[model samples]
Target: MRGLGRVLDRREEIEEIIESEHKRVLPKLAEYREKLKGKTAYITAGAAHGHAIIALLKELGIEVQGAAIFHHDPVYDNGDINSDVLSSTVKNYGDVKHYNVCNKQAYELVNILNRLKPDILIARHGGMVIWGAKLGIPTFLMEDEQFGFGYQGILNYAEKVLETFDNIEFTLNLAKHSTMPYTDLILGSSWESSLAKEIKADLLILSVPITYRLVLTCGYVGYNGGLRVAEDIYDRVLDTYR
Candidate 1:
């Protein structure tokens, strides 16, 4: 069957990627492990993305202080019970703090961050960065879920964490003087008519916007997408600090 052939081909491709990425990423992670020694992190993202990043960080010797998933699904469409994100994460990483909350709950997230007080915060959605900024914790904003897909993805994640820590002073300075509203800003909405007027955060339009902006080419789904997202975030951080 053509479908079966395509599935087999995909499996082979993924196998090759994993093998190649392991060779490429392991040495880099060894270096990163030393640079990240004793640092703790808290992650807040969607189920799959959060799980992958947590796994990669654990491998790199970063302490995962806690994690918050936006939602949880007991089983996925494939009908495999073992594929559940929550169970798999716990099984793999062991008893790190976990929370299930929606993306809009800024108050609760802030409370949790205050309680955990991790050295860094890693997040994937809009508005989450501001809480870490407000709390004076350096935050790395993952543009999408594919950020931890392959070995390069793992390297990219490590690089971003190091960059976040490298620029901690800037984040602390911003927090000291930031007057941005404590509530979540509704991107591409009339509520936040002018994002510049509301906050000084970098804006990257990644989704179907309700505003006049149109996205025809840029995507964040696969291998190339992961690279693009990493580049965009890194460039933004450089632009901010330099």
Candidate 2:
């Protein structure tokens, strides 16, 4: 009985923490939602994070223009058919247009972006950001897989997004000078292999796998993470003059 009592107490403590955090974060999120509402975004990530990001974006009143999952899992470990990532995402966030690509096929992604022309692109991997840059889309590179969980997580996300939007000019300038090396046919005989230029893209690295910049202990796990993402995106879009 004592052990059971302890377990119950711990559970209650956790609940209290959660409730406290919720109260603290919701008002800020509401503020962000007002600022971010109606904005369109295209998301590209792996299975689980893709769904999470979609949900997070919806919470901020952002419209998902489209989403592409790197892979799809037909079955989850829980053995619940309805709980699969794709089904759950649709169920929770409405019927968002989504694609399930097994690999990072740049051409396919580019085609989708061309058709959608979303206001922004959010991708999990660094490589994917280049395509968005080439197409003059503000891109957010989400590196920290674990950063979107709690109250702090969401807030961080919102801040980061706002920052990204605030710096749109840099991205545009980079895009103007950058080129997408697509196919041999596209390159043709005029393409010189020896000719290279120092060109960069306006890519906001949100977390780990930092290439140019260094980031430590950043993530997109909870409420704070969601907010951080929102901020970065807001900033990026605003900067883009979009």
Candidate 3:
């Protein structure tokens, strides 16, 4: 587990990067805040990052009508839910609905939204974003790279690359019938490597479960590419807290 000082240090790095690269995102966030005035909002956040956004909304005077906070399952080992990390930030906001990320379901989300009847839905996950859109509710996604392309994503990509290589080797071996005597050994090695890679990939995914804390606030500070505009905004707005 990382210490709070480390977390705050990471937050500082994110703040610096936002200060340098994504200067416009903060202004855009402010603009959105202004636009959201008088509109009631329903927010669902995974990990501490979600609470930060809620804090920001409250600071900007937006009416946060309801909030759903999802913590990753304890067995997943992403990290223990440290309520203390966000408690101070969200104190006056009132009781926040809590759920486990593993238990999240589209139907349950919709049912909650239907009950809340907020003017807009703000969430950190893409599925929730899509759900909001489908229900004719305005949705805003607060995200960083960890949402899709973080540790788990890297493992997924590596697995695909290895699989592709194994497929190419298997095809080559099949094409050379004249060398059938040697094919058994080559094919066996290829198959074994492929199996090993698949197993390793699966294990990585299981151990490094795609939990909310994997890419919480300030996680985007060091990345240099992809979703430039959105990443810029996410990192910048998030950096203000530091």
Candidate 4:
């Protein structure tokens, strides 16, 4: 049957894709393991940027000792992440430092972090970030994902807040580009399919009273795109205490 043949083809394609990504991640994993061999790393999960950072760090074989996962949650039923998904996809080591609030395990994670006194804290999600601030430790807040329309209002607020925080990071969007000649200025990031945001595309930011702007970002894709910026700030956060 045509449907059957199509299904088989799709399956093979998926396998090929997985194989490619695995190859890409493997060497990077080795590199990370070498650098972060013994350091304690804490990470969060709530969105793609956070997810990628945590996953990549763990994939690189970092010594992720303690974690506080704010799983923005594709994992609904199982208190634990599902087996089908990549363990690194959600957080370092599948949120190995995951704390279940029902069991008051979240408290345990905080207590453990307090005693262990980790060198770096990489956090995502709003509430956990607030908590990280209180810790007075080196912390990196993962900026959230924003679709084109969603970015306007957010950017308006962020323009003010970004003034205060040293690092306001977001995952590069994985969306197709829009080609309309006009755009708005009140927003931020947008979404697409396939891989991620490419510099070639122009984004329109919209506002209420005809104040529109186009965001033309160059050299955008993968962790390297946004991550390079984060790493700089991460270094600064570390230096502040050290």
Q: Candidate 3: worst 10 consecutive residues by lDDT? A: 178-187
lDDT of 1 by residue, 1-242 (tens): 33454777776666666678778877878999999999998888887777777877887889998888777675763668976766676787776765555644777788788778999998888788889988799987887677666567777778878877876888898887876333332323333446734565544444444364455687777999999877766665456542
lDDT of 2: 0.72
For candidate 3, the lDDT comes to 0.50
The residue ranges of model 2 lying beyond 4 angstroms of the native Cα positions read 1-9, 76-83, 181-242
Ranking by TM-score: 2, 1, 3, 4
| Candidate with maximal lDDT | 1
The C-alpha TM-scores of every prediction are: 0.63, 0.67, 0.40, 0.38
Residue 153, candidate 1: alpha-carbon lDDT: 73
Score each candidate by Cα lDDT.
0.73, 0.72, 0.50, 0.44
lDDT of 4 at 155: 32
lDDT of 3 by residue, 88-107 (tens): 66566554443234335665
Write down the TM-score for model 4: 0.38
lDDT of model 1, residue 14:
67
Q: What is candidate 4's lDDT per residue for 1-242, written digit by digit as tens?
A: 33454777776666666577667755644554565566556665544344455554554455566454444454554656553243455443565454322222444545555566665566555555433444444555555433211213323322322232344232112112222222122123343211112333223222223233243563335878567445533443344332
How well does candidate 4 score on lDDT at residue 207? Answer: 28
When superposed on Cα atoms, how far off is each prediction in RMSD?
19.4, 19.3, 26.0, 23.5
Backbone clashes, each candidate: 0, 53, 0, 18
Candidate 2, residue 224: the lDDT equals 92
Q: After superposition, how far is residue 148 of candidate 2 from its true place, in Å?
A: 1.0
